[model samples]
Target chain A: MIDFIFHFTMIAAMIIFGLIAIEHKNLIYSAISLAVMSVFLGIIYFILNAPYVAVFQLVIYAGAVTVLFLAAISLVTKAKGEEED
Target chain B: MLPLNLLWWYLGAAAALYVIGLYALVSTRNMIKTVIAIEILIDGAHLNFIAFAATPTAGIDPIAHSIVITSIIIGGCIAAIALSLAINAYKHYGTIDIKKLRRLRE
Candidate 1:
């Protein structure tokens, strides 16, 4: 029961954040949401007993990839002189 | 015990994510949003792969782990490259909206 609840919660959180990441009007907000989703997924990976995979996901997705998205957004955010998202 | 609802839960999540990602891809006009949608789609596929590879008696599959790792690497590279291209597009077009880039598309 605990395992099922844990997985179910994490998956639901991931899906919710993922939708916000893609559908949100603000780019920076979307990027942050993506990071949140990735972290939730990493927890799910850990729960699934793929500890190495979970670690890699946290290092890669939440760490490196989110940094990449933020960098690109910072560059482009000012390109148009529009309000920061 | 584990085979009963666990399998369907993962499977259902995979399906829902895939559909949501596809919908985002079709509905979104921003290049960045499209890229995010693609990431979500890949994640959905990864979930399906992991779910199917996991067995109640045997445990998680090593092969699936390897594959998911590679996929994660590739997805990161693809997202980085695509974001750069979007940046360049924004520089030229002043917007990342796909509909405005008619010359490049045709």
Candidate 2:
């Protein structure tokens, strides 16, 4: 029963995060949402008995990837005078 | 004991995610949003592989996990490259909108 609940929650959270990440008007907000989504996905991986993948998801995606994206956005934002897209 | 039938539920969810990702990719004009939609599509594929690996009949396929990992890395690399190109396009064209990027085609 616990496993079932965890599975459903993970799926729901993944879907919600994906939507928010793609649909948000602001790129920063979308990037933040993607990071949050990666953290949740890490938790889901743990629930699914893949602790290695869970840690990788957290470190590589939530940590490195998010930082990379933020850096890219900053560079682009600085180069372009206008911010709204 | 959990019935194997429960796997179908996960499969359905993965399918739904794929559909949503496809819709976003088709409808969104923003380069970043399209990139994100691609990520979501990749996530759906990863979920399917992982769920299948968890099934008792599948015997926890390490091969599938390895493939998924490789694809994830490649997907990230592709996104990074695409974003850089989009930034360059913005620099040249002064706009990231797909409609405004028709100079190369003509």
Most accurate candidate by lDDT: 1
Per-model DockQ against the true two-chain complex: 0.54, 0.44
For candidate 1 chain A, the 10 contiguous residues with the lowest summed lDDT are A76-85
- lDDT accuracy of residue B24 in candidate 1: 90
lDDT of 1 by residue, B1-106 (tens): 2364687888888888888889998998778888888888888887777776675765668999899989988988889999999899989877777876765678
lDDT of 2 by residue, B10-87 (tens): 787678678878988887777776776776787778778777876778767778777777777776787788788877
Docking class of 1: medium
RMSD of each: 2.4, 2.5
Best by TM-score: 1
- Write down the worst ten-residue block by lDDT for model 2 chain A: A76-85
Q: Give stretches of model 1 more than 4 Å off.
A: A78-85, B57-59, B103-106
Taking all chains together, each candidate's TM-score versus the true structure is 0.90, 0.87
Fraction of native contacts (fnat) of each candidate: 0.51, 0.21
Least lDDT summed over 10 consecutive residues: which range in candidate 1 chain B? B1-10
User: What's the DockQ of model 2?
Assistant: 0.44
Q: Write the per-residue lDDT of candidate 1 for residues A1-85, one digit (tens) a residue.
A: 7866787898899999998998787888998898898898788777676677778778888888889888888877764556332
